[model samples]
Target: MKARVTVMLKNGVLDPQGEAVRHALGALGFDGVEGVRQGKVIELDLVQGTSQATVKEMCDKLLANAVIESYTIEMA
Candidate 1:
Protein backbone atom coordinates (compact mmCIF):
# COMPACT_ATOMS: atom_id res chain seq x y z
CA MET A 1 0.00 0.00 0.00
CA LYS A 2 1.00 3.59 -0.59
CA ALA A 3 0.07 6.54 1.53
CA ARG A 4 0.54 10.15 0.56
CA VAL A 5 0.34 12.92 3.11
CA THR A 6 0.07 16.57 2.40
CA VAL A 7 0.93 19.05 5.19
CA MET A 8 0.04 22.71 4.96
CA LEU A 9 -0.13 25.76 7.14
CA LYS A 10 -3.59 26.54 8.49
CA ASN A 11 -5.28 29.73 7.49
CA GLY A 12 -4.18 32.78 9.59
CA VAL A 13 -0.69 31.40 10.02
CA LEU A 14 2.22 33.43 8.72
CA ASP A 15 3.99 31.85 5.76
CA PRO A 16 7.21 33.68 5.07
CA GLN A 17 8.54 31.06 2.66
CA GLY A 18 5.37 31.15 0.60
CA GLU A 19 5.46 34.89 0.57
CA ALA A 20 9.04 34.84 -0.65
CA VAL A 21 8.11 32.57 -3.51
CA ARG A 22 5.25 34.82 -4.52
CA HIS A 23 7.48 37.86 -4.52
CA ALA A 24 10.16 36.05 -6.51
CA LEU A 25 7.65 35.03 -9.12
CA GLY A 26 6.61 38.63 -9.67
CA ALA A 27 10.23 39.76 -9.88
CA LEU A 28 10.85 37.09 -12.49
CA GLY A 29 8.08 38.52 -14.63
CA PHE A 30 5.35 36.04 -13.82
CA ASP A 31 2.83 38.58 -12.69
CA GLY A 32 -0.82 38.21 -11.66
CA VAL A 33 -0.15 35.86 -8.78
CA GLU A 34 -1.75 37.38 -5.69
CA GLY A 35 -0.88 34.77 -3.13
CA VAL A 36 0.99 31.55 -2.42
CA ARG A 37 0.77 28.95 0.31
CA GLN A 38 3.54 26.43 0.71
CA GLY A 39 3.10 22.86 1.82
CA LYS A 40 4.77 19.43 1.84
CA VAL A 41 4.04 16.03 0.35
CA ILE A 42 5.19 12.82 2.01
CA GLU A 43 4.83 9.43 0.36
CA LEU A 44 4.98 6.27 2.42
CA ASP A 45 5.22 2.68 1.23
CA LEU A 46 3.68 0.28 3.69
CA VAL A 47 2.56 -3.30 3.95
CA GLN A 48 -0.46 -4.45 1.96
CA GLY A 49 -2.95 -3.97 4.76
CA THR A 50 -1.88 -0.61 6.13
CA SER A 51 -4.97 1.43 6.86
CA GLN A 52 -5.79 5.10 6.46
CA ALA A 53 -6.51 5.43 10.17
CA THR A 54 -2.99 4.22 10.91
CA VAL A 55 -1.61 6.83 8.57
CA LYS A 56 -3.69 9.50 10.19
CA GLU A 57 -2.25 8.50 13.53
CA MET A 58 1.24 8.96 12.14
CA CYS A 59 0.30 12.40 10.94
CA ASP A 60 -1.19 13.32 14.26
CA LYS A 61 1.82 12.09 16.18
CA LEU A 62 4.75 13.18 14.04
CA LEU A 63 4.12 14.34 10.50
CA ALA A 64 2.13 17.48 11.23
CA ASN A 65 2.08 20.15 13.90
CA ALA A 66 -1.52 20.29 15.02
CA VAL A 67 -1.19 23.81 16.40
CA ILE A 68 -0.14 25.41 13.12
CA GLU A 69 -0.66 22.89 10.33
CA SER A 70 -3.19 20.44 8.92
CA TYR A 71 -2.77 17.28 6.90
CA THR A 72 -4.71 15.08 4.52
CA ILE A 73 -4.01 11.44 3.72
CA GLU A 74 -4.54 9.51 0.53
CA MET A 75 -4.21 5.76 0.30
CA ALA A 76 -3.58 3.54 -2.71
Candidate 2:
Protein backbone atom coordinates (compact mmCIF):
# COMPACT_ATOMS: atom_id res chain seq x y z
CA MET A 1 0.00 0.00 0.00
CA LYS A 2 0.95 3.60 -0.43
CA ALA A 3 -0.06 6.58 1.65
CA ARG A 4 0.19 10.27 1.02
CA VAL A 5 -0.15 13.00 3.59
CA THR A 6 -0.52 16.69 3.04
CA VAL A 7 0.20 18.97 5.96
CA MET A 8 -0.65 22.63 6.00
CA LEU A 9 -1.26 25.60 8.21
CA LYS A 10 -4.81 26.26 9.28
CA ASN A 11 -6.64 29.12 7.54
CA GLY A 12 -6.04 31.63 10.31
CA VAL A 13 -2.45 30.70 10.93
CA LEU A 14 0.47 32.84 9.84
CA ASP A 15 2.92 31.62 7.21
CA PRO A 16 6.17 33.52 7.11
CA GLN A 17 7.72 31.40 4.40
CA GLY A 18 4.69 31.81 2.16
CA GLU A 19 4.75 35.53 2.75
CA ALA A 20 8.39 35.65 1.73
CA VAL A 21 7.61 33.79 -1.46
CA ARG A 22 4.75 36.16 -2.29
CA HIS A 23 6.93 39.18 -1.66
CA ALA A 24 9.69 37.84 -3.86
CA LEU A 25 7.20 37.15 -6.61
CA GLY A 26 5.92 40.68 -6.47
CA ALA A 27 9.44 42.08 -6.56
CA LEU A 28 10.05 39.97 -9.63
CA GLY A 29 7.06 41.66 -11.36
CA PHE A 30 4.46 39.09 -10.59
CA ASP A 31 2.13 41.67 -9.10
CA GLY A 32 -0.96 39.63 -9.82
CA VAL A 33 0.06 37.23 -7.07
CA GLU A 34 -2.07 38.13 -4.09
CA GLY A 35 -1.74 35.29 -1.63
CA VAL A 36 0.40 32.26 -1.03
CA ARG A 37 0.27 29.35 1.34
CA GLN A 38 2.84 26.62 1.75
CA GLY A 39 2.51 23.05 2.80
CA LYS A 40 4.33 19.71 2.69
CA VAL A 41 3.65 16.32 1.20
CA ILE A 42 4.78 13.05 2.72
CA GLU A 43 4.70 9.75 0.88
CA LEU A 44 4.79 6.42 2.62
CA ASP A 45 5.08 2.80 1.57
CA LEU A 46 3.23 0.44 3.83
CA VAL A 47 2.50 -3.21 4.14
CA GLN A 48 -0.44 -4.59 2.24
CA GLY A 49 -2.86 -4.57 5.13
CA THR A 50 -1.99 -1.22 6.69
CA SER A 51 -5.22 0.57 7.51
CA GLN A 52 -6.30 4.17 7.15
CA ALA A 53 -6.98 4.31 10.86
CA THR A 54 -3.35 3.50 11.61
CA VAL A 55 -2.14 6.10 9.16
CA LYS A 56 -4.45 8.65 10.69
CA GLU A 57 -3.04 7.85 14.08
CA MET A 58 0.42 8.62 12.70
CA CYS A 59 -0.80 12.02 11.60
CA ASP A 60 -2.50 12.76 14.90
CA LYS A 61 0.53 11.79 16.85
CA LEU A 62 3.34 13.35 14.80
CA LEU A 63 2.71 14.25 11.17
CA ALA A 64 0.65 17.32 12.04
CA ASN A 65 0.45 19.83 14.82
CA ALA A 66 -3.19 19.90 15.83
CA VAL A 67 -2.99 23.41 17.28
CA ILE A 68 -1.79 25.13 14.10
CA GLU A 69 -2.01 22.64 11.27
CA SER A 70 -4.20 20.05 9.58
CA TYR A 71 -3.55 17.02 7.41
CA THR A 72 -5.24 14.86 4.83
CA ILE A 73 -4.44 11.25 4.10
CA GLU A 74 -4.92 9.07 1.06
CA MET A 75 -4.23 5.39 0.54
CA ALA A 76 -3.66 3.30 -2.55
Q: Report the number of the highest-lDDT candidate.
A: 1
Instruction: Write the residue-wise lDDT of candidate 1 on 1-76 in tens digits.
Output: 8999999999999999999999999999998999999999999999999889999999999999999999999998
| Residue runs of model 1 more than 4 Å from their true location after superposition | none
* Model 2 RMSD vs true structure: 0.8
Clashes of each: 0, 0
Error of 1 at 47 (Å): 0.7
Count backbone overlaps in model 2.
0
Query: In model 2, which runs have C-alpha deviations exceeding 4 angstroms?
Result: none
Could you tell me which 10 consecutive residues in candidate 1 have the lowest summed lDDT?
47-56
